[model samples]
Every structure is written in structure tokens, then in C-alpha cells.
Target: MRIALCALLLTGLLVFPGVLPNSPGHLGSLAETALPWFGLGVPLLLVWAAVRRSVKEVTCVLVPAVAWVALFWPGIVDFGGRDLGRADFRVLTVNVGGDRTAPRDVARRVRATDADVVALEKVPGPAMHAYEKELGGRYPHHAVGDTLGLWSRYPLRGVEKLDLGGAWPHAVRAVARTPVGDTAVYAVRLPSVRVGLGKGFTVQERDASAARLARRVADDGTPRVVLLGDLNGSLRDRGLAPLARELRSAHRQAGEGLGFTWPAAFPLVRLDHVLVRGLDATGSTVLPDLGSDHRPVVTGLRAAR
Candidate 1:
């Protein structure tokens, strides 16, 4: 009986990670998403069995309880993010919809944060100057490309455009020198995935962008780096494998709740993200919408030991 109970726990532990990828139907992704929730039901059942003097059943419960602990403990315990000794500068990233007419208002809000550095995605041509004008004084150091831009309270260097596989100007990579240290920031917006096209989510575009991001970060060798934007897919989805392997989501580590940021009216999935590598994210959260479909993700990062 002990042997059987131990085996059951081991099997559940091994199977849990694969459930979503191998859903019951080959399996499907939905099952993967739902399996963990089903896991909660077992604990309740175990309690009832215990009260009934079902010694054998109670012992069996240990299998899943232990397995789940072994699988998820690292995420739970290692959350403080490497904890580099130096204090981190505050960084803010926003999608800043390309169509927004008043760059001043957007700039006003961005400037209000007074973050050490700011990274922007989906910047439209018309709003560029307003952003420039509004943030001009505070963020003296600046870098601008066709679409994406970076503004910093400190000096900026190594400004360049990143190719996200579609057209030009979807992403940019830059270096900012803060009083604390120098760090790399990537402002990226993956291609939009439309459910109606029969093509499903634009995984191709996201994959290509991930590939580029992986290479850039690999070569950057900066002590700290951040990738910010609307990835359009949840962490559970495999499309973000490349980026996921190298970075940690600030939301997963310090944000309140799930930190959902999409479909602002009623967020379901956390599409937009702030991923960190070679740094410790001390805090993360989702801010109220500034009129865009996606809400903003605010993350505070420090250097990693």
C-alpha cells in the first residue's frame, strides 16, 4: 500500500507538466489549463476520506501533495529574483497605441511616473513629437527610430532597431547608463494574432521575434536586461519558449494576483509582459488603462547577484 501510494504521487508529478501540452485529446491545450484546477478537487476529497478513517486513502494523498510541492517549489521559493546587491532604477513600459492623437497626454502620464528610463512600443508618427516635447526636459537622453523609441533620465548609448520579422520599426534595443548601472531595454510588439483568419494566433511572427530577441540578449551580455510589450500569448503557450527560457516574468514573481493585462474591460489572459534576465525584479503590477485595449505593466528591477 505504501509503495502504491508513492508511485501514484510520482506519476502525478511527472504527468502534471505534460498534461497541458498533451491534453487528454492527444491531448488538447484546454485540458492542460484545467488539470491543475482539477488537482484542487483531490485535496478536498482526501480530507473527507481522512475523517472517515480511510487510512489507506489518506496515505495515497501524500503522492500528489508531495509531487506538487517538488514541481512548484522553485517558482515559489526563488521568486525574489537573484537579488543583486545594488538598488534598481524604476523602468516603465507602455504600448502607447500608434493611433493615439494626443502624445502630450500620453507623455504627461509617462512623465508623471518619473521613472529612470522609459521604453515605448506602437508609437505613431503623429504622437512622436508630443512625446518628445512633453518628456524632453526630464528625459534628456533619448533614442528614436522609425517607430519604437527610448527616453531616459540618464545617458543612452548603442541605439539600434530590432527586426521583429514583419516590417521595420516594430522593436528597438538600447542601452541606458543610470547612476546605479547600465542596462539593456527591448521594446517589442509581436505581430497581432487574429482568431478569425483561420490562421489562429500569429505564432509565426512572435516566434520570429522571439528568435531575434534570444540572439540579441545572448549577445548583449549586459548585467541586466528587460523585454517589454504585448507578446499576445500567455506564458503557458509554447510560442514564447525562446524568450521564456532566458527570462523571468515580473508578474509571476511580484505582481498581485495573475496580473492580467489584456482586453482591459475584463482581463482574461496576461498577454502583455515584462520579462527580466540578469536582474532581480523587486516589484510588478498592472496599472489602470490609459485608453488602450491593453493595460500597462509596471516593473521595478534591480541588478542580479
Candidate 2:
């Protein structure tokens, strides 16, 4: 029992972040979420062993539990969402649940935030027309790929359709010329989560999209890049490892707590995100709901200038 407890703590330490395979960041992430519980549990185990008068067993459990808490507790702090400076440019990314009824609400709410650029997902078929009518004049530069779209208040270049195959927005790439500078924004929506012994997502589309986005960010030579949308996987999940490597999560820079953004009625985990690399993340945060199951993540950034 003592040896097993030590091994559990050791394994979780080694499996974090870049240490493990890229395909399963979530379960690896579970180490972060579940370890505290283990910390709480190990102490209980120590008491039991102590009651048995096995000081050796109690020592084994107590040491690791105390060490584990001390080592990984910093990760528990909310590193996402920071404060924006005067030079920082801002962007808002949200999944509005494809409901046309909220088009006006979406536009009004987003515009009110005074965000310089906006990237929206789950743009409904019915809402597309209304969205265009409401935002077209205001946001002259934009990119739309079926369900996904990017609307900017600035002049945009290299607008193209992002094909996220199989009814899910696996990927798309665009260049946004913000007042701060030009940034390549890759809007992606990965396969939904399904935990099982079997492989959950085929990952063909997800991987392909990730590869393409990574390639673009790598070769584009821009000092800044933003990948935003309903990635379907948390920043810690292995599914987003490829993407995670190339970009830093916006929320991690400024958000508080888990900042969960899914199942809007009662969000338990953050599924929507905005990741950036080569750009200095000034701040990141979640926006209130406007009829979408996924809450929006807003980020403010500044490039090396």
C-alpha cells in the first residue's frame, strides 16, 4: 500500500504537460484535478496506518501527500485572464449555439465590450443573414466557414474558408491586421469528448487542422498568433497537445479558477478558449451568455513592438 501510494504521486508528476503523449492531455490533466482529492485521501490512509501503530506506513503516506500538495498547488491558481494595457489589442471568441434569435443580442453584447476584433463560432444558418445585416457594416473584415466566423473592426487580409470536416469545425486559418499589428488567427473546433477504453475521436480532421494551423503559425513569421474557438478539449487535454505546444492559452494568463465554459446552464469545465503564441498576453476572461451553451472567452494582447 505504501509503495503504491508513492508510485501514484510519482506517475502524476512525470505525466504532466509535455512529459506524456499528446493524444491524452485530459486524463493527464485529471492528475491535476484529481490529485488534490488524493492528497485529501492519503492523509486519511495515514491515520488508518497510524491507528494500526505502523509508523512506517504512516510516514510513507504523509510525506508524499504533503510533497504533492506543495509541488502542484500552484497550478490550482487561476493564471488565465490578466489586465490589459493601453497598447494591448483585444479579441473576443465565443460559441453562440447557432441560434438566430440571439444575433442581435450577440452583436449588441459583443459591440458593447469595445473589443477590437471578434471571432465567433456556432454561427447558425438562420442567424447568418441577420448577423450579416447587424455586423457587416460595422465589421468590414471577416471570415466565414459554414458554422464558424471571424469579424474584425480592422482591415483583414488573407480571408479564407476553414473546413473543419465531418460537421465539426476542425480548422481554418486567417490573418487579422489589428491596430497593434498583423496576427494569424486559426479558428478551430475539435471533436467532442467521449471517454472510453476505445479511441474516442478518429482525430483525422482534428489532427489535420492542428497540423495546418501549427504549420501556418510556424512559417508565417508573425510575432503573434491567436487560435480561438470551441476546441472541445481543455488546454490540458492531450487532444490539444499539438495546438497547446504552439500557443499559450489566453485564459491561463488571466482567468480565475477553472473558468469552465461549457453546458452554460451550469458550466463545469472550460471548453471554449483563445490561445496565443508570439504575442504577450495582457489579459483573458469569460463573457456572459447570450443563448449559447458555450460561454465566450475574451483576451487582450500586445505584440513585441
Candidate 2, residue 36: Cα displacement in angstroms equals 8.2
lDDT of 1 by residue, 101-181 (tens): 367777777877656778777788777877888888889888877767788887888888877678765677788786557
Query: Which regions of candidate 2 fall more than 4 Å away from where they truly are?
Result: 2-81, 85-87, 164-169, 196-205
Clashes of each: 3, 21
List where candidate 1 sits over 4 angstroms from the true fold: 1-87
lDDT of 2: 0.67
Q: lDDT, candidate 2, residue 43?
A: 62
lDDT of 2 by residue, 214-280 (tens): 6656676766788888876566555456677888876666554556787777786677888887776
Q: What is the TM-score of each candidate against the true structure?
A: 0.74, 0.77
Root-mean-square deviation of candidate 1: 5.3
Q: After superposition, how far is residue 246 of candidate 2 from its true place, in Å?
A: 1.6
Query: Which ten-residue region of model 1 has the weakest summed lDDT?
Result: 23-32
lDDT of candidate model 1 versus the reference: 0.68
